[model samples]
Target: MVENMHERPGAPSAGDGLVRLYGPRFQSDPAAIYREIRREHGPVAPVLLEGDVPAWLVLGYREVHHVTSNPQIFGRDSRRWNAWKDIPADWALRPYAEYQPCSVFTEGEEHRRRGGALSDALAAVDQFELRNQVERIADQLIDTFAESGRADLMAQYALRLPVLAIARLFGLSEADAPSLAADIAASADEGEEAVRAHQRVVARMRRLVEEKQARPGADYPSRLLAHPAGLPPEEIPSDLFLTMGAAQLTTADWMGNTLRLMLTDDRFALNLSGGRRSVGQALNEVLWEETPTQNFVGRWVIQDTRLGGRHIRKGEVVVLGLAAANADSQVRPASYAHASGNQAYMSFSHGLHGCPQPAREIAEAIVQTAIEVLVDRLPDIVLAVPAHELEWRPSVWMRGLIALPAEFSPMYADRPAG
Candidate 1:
């Protein structure tokens, strides 16, 4: 057993025992539980997941580094993770095996190949096209809410913006994009049915590519249809796989977190609307402060390996503590060393398979673009509801409010400032 993680009352018990962090209270407010364990338990501690599978939740930054860096020892295959397996086959997860994209879950070169194609597309995303489309969507959303003077930002802007951006980028028709986004997100939560819905979307994208064999258009799908390397027709299916994956929840969560932070944290509001440098720092702080992913980074142990004093058996499943580890004292201070503030957050995982995008940099650009529009266009903005009352979606892997309301003067263009 590790030392007591926290000494105070209501703090969780110490050590790597089978205590449930997802237990009811922990679900309601996880921040407090994390602090309790950090104060008492060491960074890496054994956790009995679902009260059965022997697992380790690496809490401290150093331990998280250790877990993520050793992919060979810790597995990336989610199927091997027993947490999903414990669900009955008849339950939504029975077909869960087929639902996930091979890009992030698999290791080494293959993962690189799948990601490479998408990055090529990401690179190809026209700055002018993206700016033009994204701004229009922003305006569309603002227009919808302008009359009421109040609107749910999550339902209205955060969710819609990324879905629209990704839809256009992937070459999916505007008519087809919404269902695909909802289906994929559902698959993340409800399992196979949701997975099937998402799979159908992928299949549809593949069909679109095939029909365009001779008359490929100027869109993204059509470009991939005409890539110089000559992707195998079979490989085209992977494009949908990659696109479905390339820009889904990650962007949506960022939108939610950015807006939430903007509305709730006043310091963030001032700096977030500032030019690129200040905006970049603020985004980094949010990633450091509140990592949205609840799913720990997964890896399958290959050979026998002992980590953090625990022996990880061959073929055993291990997941790195993205949340716990980011909050760990060491990761923070070390990251803080270079920067002036506590901005060491890890939502995209690290080592061989972290997010390839320049997150801190691009995040500033994307949200800053949105903020500039908001500030110049609708200055006296305020949240529709009290900050504490926002609703958070459950199932530990994601941390975003389901809905956020905003209120602003509708006729800002017409009225003169006081």
Candidate 2:
């Protein structure tokens, strides 16, 4: 219904366009930049990534739905991208732009085939059992730092719990969790390093797939192996590879961001103090505000088309501004109540390409469980460093804390290990 179809009158030049994703300015405060972009270029704005690779960054709420839902026109399968045809083999984004055998990189019936496997695999998980496992991990994590009185929650808790849980779900041994976690974390980094890390992760997953094939176990990976999707032997590990990377990063970042909000924002504390809000409500707020994945990868243009009033040519890349779209004032409620009952945010995206693991639900469960366990055990927990001084990692597609240092009353962690 909102109809200002063409690019806004004062759109910036391509050379001096929106904020660069890999720069410090974006790392500092991207919301302010997103606002400036919306004012000048409407919902879809011209932006540059690490290599000055031009793309349209979609920032409007309705606009996001328009592109994501219409995968036929806005294809996610990068193998079809026309622009990459000319780029050198060593292009910085090649690692991502290149074709992978994962469902995330496919389109149409192929996507359905692969995604169905992923969805079925995820659906088979027992939510109650998953929560129980998460809680056990949370308790074990707290036990490590409970007596110290001070801990970096980012490292000691937020980042590790989800990874550990996911590793277990994949039926990996306790010893493999740390190494797999490291590979997953590194794969999310920028530049050639990310490419190298991705290769390492793929190799590790291939080994895992072979292991599961020879001696299957009662885990998600094994489920994928037995599924009716009839996924090729080569595709199985690639699917698992993508699933592991996506789950670990998003869940970890979500937990970290939510914990950061509770520790840094006095309003959240006051809400808890007055019992006006629950930790779950705080999570919805974070999803709407500081989205876990700040931005995401390319949705290649299949043909020239008009979107959000801009002229998008075939083969050009379009990135979804998940956090920015969530902040779109025209679509988002003016107050918290309007957003409360209807948990509609671009955090999980909307259509076929949306996250299949129920990341939002899993994150909420993990974060709420972790916070409740921490607060119940250490009622006096407080921030070790001032909130304003905290640092965020610079990422092309993610926004996360480097560390979340907190101080709490020391106590013995006598909880039995699972």
Best by TM-score: 2
lDDT of 2 by residue, 98-152 (tens): 7787888888998998898888888777779888988898888898888889999
Best by lDDT: 2
Model 2: residue 332 alpha-carbon error in angstroms: 2.0
- True-vs-predicted CA distance for residue 192, candidate 2, Å: 2.5
Off by over 4 Å in 2: 1-18, 85-92, 270-277, 357-359, 413-418
- Report the lDDT tens digits of candidate 1 across residue range 168-251: 765567777677677756654443465476567667767877866856665666666566545566667655654554356656
Query: Alpha-carbon error at 140 in model 1, in Å?
Result: 1.8
